[model samples]
Target: MSALSQLDRGVAPIETGMLPRPFVVRSRREELADCVTLELAALDGEPLAFEAGQFTMLYVHGIGEVAISISGDTAKPDSLIQTVRAVGAVSQAICGLAEGARVGVRGPLGNSWPVERAVGKHLMIVAGGLGLAPVRPIIYWALANRDRLKSVDIVYGTRAPDQILFARQLLGLSAADGVRVGITVDLADQDWSGQVGVVTDLIPSMLRDPDETVAMVCGPEIMMRFSGQALVGAGVPAEETFLSMERNMKCGIGWCGHCQLGPHLICRDGPVFAYPAVRDLMSVWEL
Candidate 1:
């Protein structure tokens, strides 16, 4: 059983800076080299209510806390889901933890994808590299709420076919009702036979009602920039498109300016925003 299963439910999420809450790893999945998807169950009374695209600050005792996106199925909020890529000390430590390990979790922080707004609109989800982690919940939402949208299309790109996230599931989702998935890779070996090139290369073939399409993109800045341009070129409005921004966030709340970009604090105002809102700022390298 998870350590969280034995702990008591604490307090309401009425404030920030509260000591981290106890949570235990219920399960985990290895998606690629250096990446692990942790399914956590909070040892408490009720699970934190979270929307698609939000993130949490996860604390691995003695190491540190890092802002990781909530990567679980939205319908299963009681189960905390986060995907960690071991690119740093803290993430490496998180990746080393096994099932049933205990950790501190302190959020459902940051803003979320505008799923409600995109409900009646056609949808285009673009993800690159580890970017797919943040976009997973939205895909889940789209799948469950397929009737609310005109269409749902996903374009994913990774270092290689081997680096793709949710490889097994993508195969199933490709055949799911009202959803279309297209994948591309930077390079491939003889054993691989999928599309080769950046994700944007597949955008043209995936275009569907760009004028009415609301795109949500989470990826490297360069990839997002080009994807946005391509979508806009295809008639998707800048204001109707969205992107998730990554910054050096210390505190999960707005009190910390570490995640500031122009007049917006990424923690509070967004990790996700309309393309027009931050299009100019995103042009400024590493802001």
Candidate 2:
């Protein structure tokens, strides 16, 4: 997920940019074998107002910090929610935090999806694996503003049926009016009844009007590249389709050059960008 071009949303908390605020873990839910979703409340009683798609740097005491996207409802700013997959030392520490555990938080930072631009236009959200965590905020925003938009289509693909995140919620969303949810897994077992294929295979079916659709896609680099191409091939304007980029970010802000991608910094210029903005760079091998 990314942010708006300008940092004028006033979405950041009251604390200074570089400082971390005290937040207590209010709840934790296990989403997978190594993934957990945590809800945190600020100890100072201040709400971290954030735009959908922005992320935060979560710091576990005696451990370290890692950037994770906000995965809660934007309407509820007082409680911060983030889903963590225990892939690294810092992330594992975050995933292991128990209820009432205290942690340091910096941000609610970076750009957001240009959701307002999708108003009066059909919106499509696509995600793969944990990419859903970053793009989940947009789904919440779209559902809240359903009347303002034409339609909402969500296409998600993961490795297996057991790997699905927010399964019950996704089931309920499929029944919501004006919303279409299509889920697929790369492989399936005897108990699975859903489609089995890459996410792109389901894209054309969910799209109502290709030219009038605005898409937001987040996944691995190759998946996003193909998705962008598919959207353009189906008649959506390249500029109207956005993809979130990820890199090895040391500093959530752009101070460190670890996240540089050619001329752009993944942490600053984007984590989200229109397809045209990153199309060429994405084609390069490990640039």
Candidate 3:
């Protein structure tokens, strides 16, 4: 009934240069807790060029499609990286897949975070729980071009200490000059000596120029709502704060009605939106 299904049945395999080729998984690793990192090699041995913050729709045969943000750099186009959390049936299938398995992929889709606009401005990134995956690319980009940006700060929060993703990598970034990093956990373990509180509390201590800084936040809707308020209260402008939204994105393209929120579709217009753009929509329930 779906367009993809119809195409699969009726369309002949044509060598269209524009169509994306199915890539095979070269390796997969279990990262942090309950997360899988997949490294895919293109079937044709060509690299996929994509901007930071763009996502791809990965399709599993006889299963379903899931939108995964591309975690690797565009400069290294030979391989692609996707970090996914095992949270659903489809995701479980992806997590269960082994090396050399074939998976269909389409995209480099959606608008990326405005990295160009972020240049020359102090950047503040706040990520919570699995929200870290979507923002990971931006962090990598900032570090890769450290001299271009003025200052960088990252604040990541998870349910508990064990739930934190990219622990060693974040710690390394924190030690780098001109980059400040902080981690918070809702509940602390015996060994956890760092900050023990909500992520909002850490915002006040980070040195930032409210007028010249841009804050990007990705997390649960409730978390982002409160975080946005906290940033605004700290003198960061409303327009300077951006939030990445999550909804049931049944279709990666705009045709499906599953991800509609107000005048936009999470699959099309967002997944990332400036805070003011979706403020009203976030206020409504089941939107």
Which number leads on TM-score? 2
Q: List model 2 lDDT by residue over 163-207, tens digit each.
A: 999888876885456789999999999999999999999898878
Candidate 2 overall lDDT versus native: 0.89
What is the lDDT for 287 in model 1?
Answer: 70
Query: Which has the higher TM-score value, candidate number 1 or candidate number 3?
Result: 1
Segments of candidate 3 deviating more than 4 angstroms: 1-20
Q: Residue 278 in candidate 2 has what lDDT? A: 94
Candidate 1 residue spans exceeding 4 A from truth: 1-14
What lDDT score goes with residue 260 in model 3? 84
lDDT of candidates 1 onward, in order: 0.87, 0.89, 0.81
lDDT of 3 by residue, 171-200 (tens): 777554668999999999999999999889
Backbone clashes in model 3, listed as residue pairs: none
| TM-scores of all candidate predictions against the true structure | 0.92, 0.93, 0.91
The deviation in Å at residue 185 for candidate 2 is 0.3
- Name the TM-score of candidate 3: 0.91
Comparing 2 with 3 on lDDT, the higher-scoring candidate is 2
Q: Which stretches of candidate 2 lie over 4 Å from their true place?
A: 1-16
Q: Estimate, for each residue in 171-242, the C-alpha lDDT of model 1 and write its tens digit.
A: 678555779999888999888888999988999889888888899999988999899888888899888999
